[model samples]
Each structure stands twice: as C-alpha cells, then as structure tokens.
Target: MQDGTTVRDVMHRAFLGVSESDTLGDAAELMLAEGADCLVVVRGGEPVGCLSPRDALGAILDGADPGETTVDEVMAPPAPTVPADSRIAAAEERLVAEGSSRLVVTRDGEAVGILTERDVLAAGTTHPSAGAEHAVRGSAADVGAAEEAAVDAESADAPTAEATQSICEVCGTLTAELSPSNGQMLCPDCQEV
Candidate 1:
C-alpha cells in the first residue's frame, strides 16, 4: 500500500469515536476505558473535531462546567487527516510539521481508524521515524497490562494516603509525581531511549 510510507500504514483500524454532544466526563471515561489519547468527534457520521486528554485536563483545571460542556466546545477542529494507504514515514513527518500528536485515518472520506505515536510503536516495525515517537501498541503479552493500566488510570483520582505518580509516558515506569511531564519519572536517560 503505497510502499507503506505514510501514517495510514501503521494506524489502527479499530477506531473509538465519540459524538460532539458528549460531555467531557464521558469522554474521560471513554478514554480511560479504551486507553485512548484522543476521541474523534463525529456528527451525522462525519468527523468534525477531536477531544484530547490534555484538553480535558485543561478544562478541569480551569473549573469549566464539564457536565454541561459538549465535546464540540473543547475539541480541536480541522483535524489533520490521512488516507489509509499512506506511508508511515510520511505520517511521522506530518505530525512533526503540524506539531500535533493525533491524526485521523480515513477511507473514502469516512473515518476508519486513528494513528498515534503509541500506535506506531506498538506495531513492532523497525522503520525509522520522528524524533519524538513511541511504540505503544502492545502485543498479546501486554494486553493484560494495558487493561490493568487503564483500570488504574480510571481509579487514579481516588483519595489515598500514599501519593503514587503516573506511569512514564515513554517507559510506563510507575513513579511518584502524580503526573510525570516530559517523561521525567524515568529520568532523562530512560526517556531518551
């Protein structure tokens, strides 16, 4: 498929989409349940935008009315998209050029799947890619761990005496920073790997 050079090559076909009318809370719930970084905001079967975890967190920190707010109100519009036949390398370039972490994968102008840095890494491809990328798509051996991590993320906000940190975004190492930014929990060396 086009020499497998674009983002479409490595994207996951099983997409987890959401509606623009859904609430931020619902989106968060879905993300935690699905281990998704972003959800497609579709209206009448047409994609309009995307809801990302960072956006939701920003809204939460701002004290926005998540219950009343719809995904449309917070989603980023005109999402960068690519055909399913594109090369993975091209997709990596697009992500860097756009300064975006998410890309929509379409077939015949309809949403079919989604591509993320994690997805690319999970594919087990040895091809070279962008400077900042991860292979998060896990194998069968990692499914249970992924599910457990999802559950942990879902229940992570609960009150507790101990302050456990978020897993490293790059290495999945559990730490004690609540949320580790820039992969600091693993130290600079591990993050560079």
Candidate 2:
C-alpha cells in the first residue's frame, strides 16, 4: 500500500444489498447468509437506506413482527458515502464528523464497498503515521487525565439506574430500554406485542 492509501485499498468489496420491500426477516437471513453486519436497501437499483443488524434488532425490540415489518420501515437513511478514490484519512474524518461506524464506498455513484472503524483500526496498526498523529495531538498522560476528569464529573452528577441494560441476541445492539419476555432480553422495539 502507498503512504497515501485510498478507501478502495482497504474497503471490503463484498458488500451486500436488499430490496427495500423485503421483510426484516429476509434482511436478517441475508446478513447471516452473507456474513455481513449490514445491507444496503435498494429501490430500482438505487440505494435508499441501510439495514444494519442493529436496526433489525431494534425493530424486534419495538415489538414489530420481523416477518411483517418491511426493511424500508426500519432501515436507517442512506449511509454517508465516500468516493472510492478518496483518501482513507478523508473517510476517517467523515466518519468522525458523523459519529458513524462505517462509510459506504462508491464508484461512479454505485456502491462498491464498505469501510468500517475496524478496518481503519487495522490499517492504523500497520501505519506509523497513525500513531504519530495521535502523539502530536496530545500526550498519553494528557488524554488519561482528561478521561479521568470527565468520568469524575459524570459520576458526581450521576443518577441511579432506572432500567437494566442488555444486548439483543438477534442484532447485538446494547439497550437500556428493554423488556424481558420468555427469558429473552429485548429492546422496546423488539418486544412482542
């Protein structure tokens, strides 16, 4: 890889897609079959939204029947995308700005791949500049002190827990607003009616 690598250099090319009309169950099955965490929701060959494992689980938590709920009803709005040739740093910047975990990589306006935070982390592990940039920004001690202060401030004003937090089995989204049913911990959206 070059010193100035682009998103295409590290993006996962085996991206998956699903029809917007498809059911949540269908989307989940597709993810399982493809071994993917998300699927692009398309309508007439154009991307309209993104159906992540979290969305699927959230729907189930909200008590929507997966088989009856359509993908369009639960999918997040179209994911932010970057051109295939965009620098990886640029993609990372976009991700940070949007507070997103991944970005859709496009080529000629067509979805071509996906770049996730994990991918960026892996890339950083092998690139010396990544660590240098962080060092230049702040010393490790400085960061630790800042984190400790933030935690201390938060704890000083912390409120008692009102509900238990749990991870959804189906989609892996952690939620505090949950319901327990039939020994299953579900988010409010996934709880059965």
Candidate 3:
C-alpha cells in the first residue's frame, strides 16, 4: 500500500542543527533559543550526530566541564539518516531499528529536513503493523502496540545517537563501549590518538 508520500513531503523545512566542534553550552543555548529539543551536528557538510536536551543534562550531571566539552563529545553518533526520497514506511522501520526519535532527511548527502514521530502522527501516517493499527483504533489486546510503535517511531525518527561499541587499537577490541570522534569509534584509552 504505497501512499506515494516521500519523507521530503512531510519533513519540517526549518530544522536547527549544530556542528561537532561547538561547545555543549553553545549547543544548549541554541536549542533553547530556537525552542528546539535536539540540535543536529554536522561535519564535512554531512549530517553526523545530534545533541538533545537529555544529552546536555547528562553531561552537566556527570560533572563535565562545559567549556571543555564539545558537541562531538556528547553528540550521539552513527546518526541514522534517510534519503529524501525514502518511503514513509521504510523510515518508520529504521526508526524502530535504531531506537531514535528523529531522522535527518538528506539529499546528495546534505541534510535538508527532519522527521519526528510526532510529525508522523500529526500527519496521520498509518502504523507499521496490524497490532499497531488495532491499537490505534482502540482495540484492547491492551497491548498498546500502536503506542509502543509511536514510542519506537519517535526515537527511530531521530538521527542516530552514539553507539555502544567502538574499535580499540590498544586493547584490540573491535566493538566495545567507546566514545565517538568524527564518526569513528575509539576506546577511552585510544581516544587521544
């Protein structure tokens, strides 16, 4: 059942984004001033990561020296992105798989728009599964599949956040709890390189 609606058709044209080198405080300030919850981070003219209010709060709570911290330090990495022409259903699937709330819509590798779960619901896009459709129609599997899907969609629709694994040159760990630097995963000890 193709509705012939592209993500570009439904994406928000005006999105607030940031750069990787920006300070945490700066990113937060921008987000607040712009009335945005998330700030997209870019590098080499490409969508990279996103900084959310949650991320800023976590960094602050962790005693991160705001002046020394950069968006690259806290911005979520491996940002799940979608082509401008992507099908709404495909976008919905990625939103579930990546556990993100927004998706950066790109054209020729350049970000053009953003799609959020709320945006999807507001547009009345059908839920992904039969269970979801039933839930939306108020069927009591009491399962609330649609609600769950909404949650998943909201998170998935967002750009990718930091990954849990990285490649460590020192410990020879191909994928371990590590931080992101310019989209490459580096273990805590190997981050200096």
Candidate 4:
C-alpha cells in the first residue's frame, strides 16, 4: 500500500480460520502446520471468535482433552472489527482503544483479512509523520478524555479493570502496560527479546 493506503491495503490476507465446533486437536494441528499463534474463529462464514494459543494451552492445562474439547470452549470473542475501506489511522486508534493488538477485517459483512498494530507501525515508519498526519477517526480521537471519564465512571459504571490490565502473551506476566512485539504482547523484560 502507498502512504494513503486503506485498511484493506495492508491487512493480512491469510485468514487461518477454524470453526467453534472444531476439535482442539484439529485446531492445534492446523495451527502447528501453519505456524500460527492464533486462528480466526468463524461460523457460517461469519467471524465469531478467535482461537488463540493461550486458549488451547489453558484448556489443556485444565485437563480438557484436546480431541474431545471443542474450540468453542476455549476461543475468545472476536476482536473489534473495522471496515476494509476505513482509514489506517482509524484502525490504529481502534486497536489501542480496544486494548488489543489485532483486529478482524470485514468487507461487505464478510470476514476478510486480519489487521495488527505492527501493520500500522510498519506503514507509519515508511513515512515519518504519517502517524501525526493522520488523525484518529470519529470519537476515537477522544480516547484521553474518555479514559479520564471512565475513572469517575468506574464506580458507578461497568468495571474497566479487565480492560486496563493485560497479560503478556509470552511469559504470562500480568500488567497494565504492554506493547506488541513479534505478534506477542510483551512486558518490559520480554520486549528486550
């Protein structure tokens, strides 16, 4: 994609998809063969959830039989989605606002490619100031204000504790601040690696 490329332009077209009904063994096999850390969970050709390596590991550690356990039992809800035609800046904002490293891409109500923060970063690095040149779309530009409001809203509103705290995908370290590295959420220590 050029400097002004759309989300569709830079997204990962390879969607390693698995259904919720698939057995963990089958999912693991596909994941291993594909060298994937996660797979898109789909149903009836619609994006439904995500099957992450963490999910499968947790299930196995909890004594769930891989051959018998369904992907539904371990998959996570699908990440936030954005239209393929959306701006790269907006997609980046969504990734941060949603506190996720990845997002599902949609085109005309159909699940298409996957987008990651790294993709955005790569695009930004190509053109210095690209990050500044592009403003976050819509209300996403108000993340700072929203976060401030959420502080007061926490007691009277829904809990944002889970949203603030993140578990490092590599070492399972739980902390609030994390950055994506090599497709994994890394803590300060792991980031060095």
RMSD of each: 12.5, 9.6, 12.6, 10.1
Ranking by TM-score: 4, 3, 2, 1
Candidate 2 root-mean-square deviation in Å: 9.6
Each prediction's TM-score against the native?
0.58, 0.61, 0.63, 0.67
Whole-model alpha-carbon lDDT for candidate 3? 0.68
Sequence-dependent TM-score of model 4: 0.67
Considering every candidate listed, which one attains the maximal TM-score? 4
With candidate 3 superimposed using the best TM-score fit, by how many Å does residue 128's alpha carbon deviate from the native? 8.6
- lDDT, candidate 4, equals 0.73
Off by over 4 Å in 2: 125-193
The alpha-carbon root-mean-square deviation between model 3 and the true structure, to one decimal in Å, is 12.6
Clashes of 4: 0
Candidate 4, residue 65: how far the Cα is off, in Å: 1.0
Give the per-residue lDDT digits (tens) of candidate 1, residues 1-193: 1344456556777777889889988898999999876788887656788887878888888887878887888887846887778777666556546645557887778888787645544553232222322223466446335535444554455434242322444554333333435644452434445
Ranking by lDDT: 4, 2, 3, 1
**Per-residue lDDT of model 4, residues 1-193, tens digit only:** 3546899888998889998999998999999999887799998768899988778888999999999999999998987899999888788777767867788999876789998866765554221231222222123234334334444445344454444544466754434678888887787757866
Please give the lDDT score at residue 94 for candidate 3. Answer: 72
Question: Which portions of model 4 show Cα errors greater than 4 Å?
Answer: 1-3, 125-176, 179-193
User: For candidate 1, what is the TM-score?
Assistant: 0.58
In candidate 1, stretches whose alpha carbon ends up further than 4 angstroms from where it belongs are 1-9, 121-193
Candidate 2 vs candidate 4: the TM-score winner is 4
